[model samples]
Target: MKIKIPTHEDYQSHDGLHYYQLWNSIGDEWLCPACGRSKFQIMKWTQRFPNTPHSFMGWVAALHKHHDHSIGFFEPGQTRFPETLICGQCNSTDGVVKRMLNLPSNFSFSPQEMRTFIQATPHGKHKINYDQALEIFNLRATNKNGIPKVY
Candidate 1:
């Protein structure tokens, strides 16, 4: 069977994603667009989850329907859909990074936008790490307004 590469349209979720469709569209091999990590990699990483009795289940549970939080919050179990699938870690890190960099709350890096920020090195695939985000912040900070703490 020919693999049908999913368009951006396919990933937009309003109600929620169908896991079966994800298995079919991207298969077992697709990487998370935000950090370029694969599901298996995320699963292995989740094995060492420091907190929670359901640690082993973290892998499946980590697959989050990451959406625009600026859109407003939904009540628990209220079927908040996705902009795309990102591991729980990346989704949380987005918050951390925004705070660290003082980016606007609504500001977010889209998958393709995020791709530009990641650094590819010979040391295998890594997340769009904090260092990368820091570098970007430094460049923009120096060029635009100049950070107070930074020279």
Candidate 2:
């Protein structure tokens, strides 16, 4: 299947297959279609947001490995780039809401998933308490679900 990737130009996801642009870019890292949104701002986390677990590690590595796209927040006062998602065009709170709902179905796996997937064997089972598990979903500056509900 020919999957369209993000370039310097903007492209939208058709059907169920949406390409998400990277929040940070590291020196010539391949840009896919998702990276070309109008709201795409090249921002980095101060200390890696809890939301991105595996990606945090990878992003750190990219910063060290590459000369460009060093992992740091976008400098204050610049043209607001694409990929923000909260902007007028592609305002998607669902993505943030889904971030909090980290079930296997939700795509945002909790720490439990890491423990279960990495520590547990196929025969072993790691049971998670739904109430306690939801605590992992708390997003800073946003609602508990992690999505910005009110503008």
Candidate 3:
């Protein structure tokens, strides 16, 4: 099954700002347009089954169901697609900005580093899934902030 994700232009303009506002109102990373805080009232969506209605609906039925999900809280050109974070205060789109704040020490091993590590270790084997190299590189460990520090 193919899930349709909006294209880059679907969410952002040439200047890197959000062109749509609807996502900012409901998504977790969106700041409050009025309060400028990363908090908002959680809205629940009721899923309905198509044709033959039932409380526990099948995926196929859910897909065919016609449900109105629009809350009308935001306007067009108010949000950007592919954005993980939105500044609700000014309706500014900050995609991946928060994630790049810090790199944890564990991500230091690049793909080349992994290859070298595996080759140098005794009893090591080179494979796409380098379990042995991972141990030597310590790529699994991360900082408290969860940013990739070592890459």
**TM-score for each of the candidates:** 0.46, 0.20, 0.15
* Pairwise lDDT winner, candidates 1 and 3: 1
For candidate 1, lDDT tens digit of each residue in 1-151?
A: 2323323333332112234444445545767776676644443212433576755522231455577653432233432334987655566666777887777675455454455665432113334566667665444335335643322
- Model 1 clash pairs are none
lDDT order of candidates, top first: 1, 3, 2
* TM-score leader: 1
- TM value for model 3: 0.15
Point to the candidate with the largest lDDT: 1
Cα RMSD to the true fold for all candidates: 11.1, 17.6, 19.5
* Runs off by more than 4 Å, candidate 3: 1-106, 117-126, 139-151
What TM-score does model 2 achieve against the real structure?
0.20
CA shift of 113, model 3, Å: 1.6
TM-score of predicted model 1? 0.46
Per-candidate Cα lDDT values, in order, are 0.50, 0.26, 0.27
Each model's backbone clash number: 0, 15, 18
